[model samples]
Target chain A: MDKALLSTRNLHRSFGGVHAVKDVSFHVPTGAIKAVIGPNGAGKTTLFNLIAGTLTPHQGQVIFRGQPITGHKPHAVAALGIARTFQTTKLFPHMTVLENVMMGRHTRTRSGFLAGMFNAPWTWREQRQTEAKARAILEELGLTAHTNETACNLPFGRQRLVEFARALATEPSLLLLDEPAAGLNIYETQQLSQLILKIRDTGITCLVVEHDMSLVMNISDEVVVLDQGHKIAEGPPAAIQRNPEVIRVYLGDEHA
Target chain B: MRLRIYYPVLATAVLIVLLHLALAYADATYYMTQITMSAYYALVVIGLCLLMGYAGQASLGHAGFFAIGGYTAAVLTTYNLRPYADAPFVSLCRALGLTMQWKDLYGTDILSFTPWAAFGSALLLTGLIALVIGASVIRLKGHYLAMATLGFGLIVYRIALGTPVLGRADGISNVPPFHLLGSLQVNGRAPFRIQNYYLAWVVVLIAMVLALNLVHSRVGRALRSIHENEEAAHSLGVNTYRYKLAVFVLSAIFAAMGGALLTHYSGSIGPAEATVMKSVRYVAIVAVGGMANLWGAMVMGILLNFLSLRGVFGSFDDTVFGAILIMMMIFAPQGLLRVPRLRALGSLVSRRSHA
Candidate 1:
């Protein structure tokens, strides 16, 4: 209600005759950590894609920061303060970890081609600043020692952290993380939860599409329950835990 | 801070300058002239390196831009205007402000303009054509992009061959020789190969410096990112399409400049100079030298050209070049310059205990 940072009005998407997403509507309140959870085929990822401009809906619209962003390209949407991490880590594999993070700062850097080519004073200053900021982020994520290592050479858990650092480099007001906890072990998941809370403390809104219920329930301020592409329930984590429909669909009848 | 980088660059510069002076004094006109042409080819290879090595774009139509530049210089220098009845295309160009003067209509064989003016005009014309081509075809990627550029090159070659005023398949000859500004009267004489050699070297130096600056810039980094993963770069808010177009256009301009300088030095223009095979030769130069290393391209260009001139390589230049490219791709795809020995050399010296 506090001026939702992102809102969707009956977003719909279809792949030929199969309806992938059906009239799904949701609003992500600004600065809140929210999660969308459902079965694998219940359209959680599709919904995230539609909101992030990766897929255009067959009907309805997505509004970000009070402006229509329904049909903007992914890069254009990202430029307008929406950044996402892929479900599978999409690190620039050949680049050094620092360089991979530095790419996220691409849109923020103010130097032009001529200035960069000439190594102008302003461009050099900006380059150093960006690198320093990238290093700081890596340090925070415990990846400072791997700054010069190529992304592909890092262990899987650490690669995910690098991906998060790269996403943070974009300085996004709204972060759309796709399964940030997938493939992460128990220790990594705990660290990821702490990281998410730290991110939330920075006053940035997060919409996480995750299947790790324990992680989601522990960190999310609010949870939106989806069953077959329609919202079945939405509330604080405690209330959602007792909701019968959520129990029948997700928590199992035995738990109920 | 990096003595390895500084010392080598300094030594290379000193050697080049001493060699140039020796050639000037010893009157080794032919070898100096060959070095001049090699220098121009090196410039073209530098642009090709940016396109193929860093951006991961392939082009087989660079010869088209090269030929266009050659003809542009030839037309401006020797045949600015032709008999009206014989050359309707020249007449049209004259009317369109493409050609600078209408000397034939004035019943004068000589039109007044400095050699430098003609050179500048040719370079400008080459850049304009490359801009148009780049805008039209840069949207394409992969083999389709290569085929589109190759088509453009063939079309330009055909135009140069068919247009009678443009030398009608034979190309124009007896170009006015280049002169050092204010120092000598070498125009319209036996080719001033020595002056042209120095001129070509100057152009090559400028191209090398420009390329070195570009590879270290943000645009260069953006291009390398796009090459690695386009979707990831876009998701990070990089304008991938615009950067691709910018590199394509810049590479074409460099190729055009190289062609213009080569034509001026040779004192002739030919359709064969801008053939599809010639374009592939440029690609091979960059491929063998290492795609990401600009200095490697320079070394390979000089080596390839030197081999060809020595008659040791003979007409088997393409076969030998192709073999080297294949070997590089298989054994050291990153290029000879990127071998681990070179990377370890600096660290070895610094770690004195190990050394």
Candidate 2:
């Protein structure tokens, strides 16, 4: 049996009087494309934050590669080979696209404050390799033409592409994407679906939070449907499509 | 370092050196003195660039750190609290053929430490203080961070005004210049001010190189990452809190070193050095230069301070700085370098209003 790359055990969290997440438990097997889908206010993003270590679970454990990371900070989780993207694009406005991608490579590199200030030879070598790596990702994603443009100036869809490239720069074993297709048009969405499959082809596991049901149904190997902070159903895409609870969660109870 | 990559720093250095020679040849030694003094403020502003501009940790009490540095150097270079060799404890040591660094000569105690020693200790002390303060308050964002630092500055100012051991309101005088190679001394000698001028610019040059390198390297990227979006930077393994604290400490050390240099140059230190307004003045200089641009800080810090020093604005330097800050926040928030962009924006707004 394939081992789980990431697993959450009995995760529970509450903000104020509202329970944002409740007794949520799931496992992502190695090299699987898993989709977590829901309507509004279903705690999908909160769940992503918990796994990415942005928010600590009120009760439960987040295990990555069989190691407990329940209360670790975001940077610690990133260092341990998990990378994620925000729903709203968050690129450094002043830096060029290449620079923004290179910024993501900062974690995987070894040049520290002292080495940077002094411009050590090893730092230079690492920087060259970093730039080359960033350029290759840009080229692969058809972003080479916009490599030197400031990230803030890119069009909305391209900005999303840049974020994907930046997240990929961390070379994570598992990538968590939040609302990756929230605003993309049909062509861009199709391109993104292809890219997600390509990423999975490279053996990187994906845990995607999405609102686009078509994209979710098309790309997901396994589906987890969430509604009002509870998991309504979990199974293969075909099984989830037929589940009455998930149908009721997406539609009205009368429609179900 | 690649000379090719550092063209700007090299060019700026040469330009400054040439400007110095031109002023000397034109017999404007007094003007040169004012420029040199501005360099000290420029040093403080550069560090503020790293802290506020790059790391996005706004501090309004940098003058407090400056005061701490000046006073540390002043007290160590001028006063002696410990009894000398002829005193009972010291005499016993001498009777046993042992010696201590703090010597008591016949009952009079004087400061025996070199100015360089004082400078080094002041730097270390400021780093330690900044570490504590930064660790405590780095999580405060925007105005809260500013207010916390402002309170710290005000407290330091009041303490300096009230403490007699720190010379109270009058401060300490006759701070000796640092000695190099055991014999040659560097000080702000009036009529020429040659040594002080070179020393100040030399430090500025090194600060610019280091600051530029820091802003361009991976650490620099991490800092810029935090500046743009703290949450995003954290998720990318930037360790936002640690980087903020580290940059804050580094900025404090720079300001302290500059303050110690100013103390030695003026040969006196005063409680006025700890004033809250002085800290805000530094923020204004960096703002006018450009946010997160190190060279802009150097140019604007030196120019604005020189103008104030030459009595161009009389006693209204504070007013001028305030106005500049407001204007920058409105018209040129990207800084002086982007004034053309601001003009374009202004025209666009005007066109919309006309329509």
Candidate 3:
């Protein structure tokens, strides 16, 4: 078996006795697209938060790139070649779409305060390179036309694309996307699923927490099932589809 | 690039022309001095604009930095140890024909140094204090940050008022005038108010240029990111805390340099200058001018300072600013600079079409 790009060991997080995640352990293999799917309140988002350093686990360790990164800050995680998009689009508003993505190139580039203030030649060179890289990513994501528009001014579906482009600009080895297709229509969903596959093909490991079974099952190489803070099952998408426990807890459980 | 050079050069030439006009009419009168005083306030407001406008952080301890700068200048300029000095440096100073100039006031001998030295030391001291204090304080957001900064300002104000060596409420006076590049003198036995006026505006211009360069850089984008959504910036690999602290300390340096120069120009210092109200006025000036627009803040600062000096709006300044803050927040909240969002877009489209 190939080494996991990211691994979590028995993670536990609770809020005022409400356990959001309990004894959750998972691993995303390098260069593979993995999805964590479950019912609402199944602790999928909370688990993503723990891995992204938004919250510290009560009992667990998150290992990334063969290094323990438990309790590291969000920026530290990003600096360590891990990047993520929020459940909601978290792009900087009042900034141009290109600028938003260019910001992601921060950790990848080096420039000090004085250097930036003075607009040193090296700073300009780095900035031009950053802009070129950002524009290329934006172009690849079909967002080049709106590069100069304000980020928030974009339509919801387009905003999500912009965010994905931004996360990609970080040059991350691991990308944690929280429901990238949550607010999208079926067409947009299919497009996003295709994009996720494309991202994985680019040699980036993807850990996506999504509710759309069709989107998750279509693109993910492996799917982990969660319900009420417990991992009920984990396997290939076809096996998870056949697993009776996942069926009972997630797919079979329907809203009245 | 030419546009950048054009605007700044045009601005400098215009300010110089205004100074030329003022110098021609003025006989170095008290009113002329007050107008120059307005120039220094403009510098302080420029600092606040960078802080509140771009970084989206409010500082209530801004005046604390200013007072720190003032006192640092005062100590460097007025603390003479010549007659009672037993230090070897004092003898060396006399032997090398570099004895610091001295003055006598209220039966006390005061050591006076050149203006540039005082300004340099003031900036260094204020920057050091600001860097330490800003690291912890800028972690706070919104009103909590404001309260923390206010607490710092209050603390500094009290220390300056109660501390004896700082001259308590009186503050250190007889601050020596600085000679611009060691040729043009400002405020001494043969004081030159025009020189000081030109010097003050020149500093303001340099500061403006620095701010322009900053806002056009990657650091500027990083700062605005911290303002809009700090967590998003952090997630994007921006050290939000570090950038916030950097801007805080830089803005404090701006205020500190202004205060240091003003202390020298005014030829006196006072603890009253460091009061919380003064800090709020700086905030008000930035707010009224539109926090994001440096030029707007500079203009409003000069205009308001003139009004306050003329006794036309002395006590009413705060009341007017408070009302303006309320109205602007309600009507234009992004800032006084921008009209309502729809109108702003409408204007933008209209202007674009025209262009």
lDDT score, residue B151, model 2?
Answer: 91
Per-model DockQ against the true two-chain complex? 0.53, 0.57, 0.56
Where is the poorest 10-residue window by lDDT in model 1 chain B? Answer: B346-355
Error at B153, model 3, angstroms:
1.4
Error of 2 at A52 (Å): 0.9
lDDT score, residue A215, model 1?
A: 95
In candidate 2, the residue pairs with backbone N, CA or C atoms under 3 Å apart (3 or more residues apart, or in different chains) clash, namely B84-B104, B85-B104
Where is model 3 chain A poorest over a 10-residue stretch in terms of lDDT?
A: A247-256
Across B1-355, the per-residue lDDT of candidate 3 in tens digits comes to: 3134236446665877776787667753455577677778788888888788988999888889888888888787787766655578766655654336656566666545545666787888888898998887889889999999999999999999999999998888877776566576656333576666667677777787778667767788788888888988988888888888988989999988878878878788899879998888888788777777777788788878778877887678667767777777677767754665455754432221100
Which consecutive 10 residues in model 1 chain A have the weakest lDDT in total?
Answer: A112-121
The candidate maximizing TM-score is 2
lDDT of 2 by residue, B26-97 (tens): 988678778888898888999999998888788998998988888998887776634574678556644653
- List native contact recovery per candidate, as a fraction of 1: 0.68, 0.75, 0.66
Regions of model 1 farther than 4 Å from truth: A226-232, A243-256, B1-9, B21-29, B82-108, B112-132, B178-180, B184-191, B330-355
Q: Give a tens-digit lDDT track for model 1, residues B100-186.
A: 432333455633233555667766776777678777887688889889988987888788878888888789776655554665533
Error of 2 at B22 (Å): 2.2
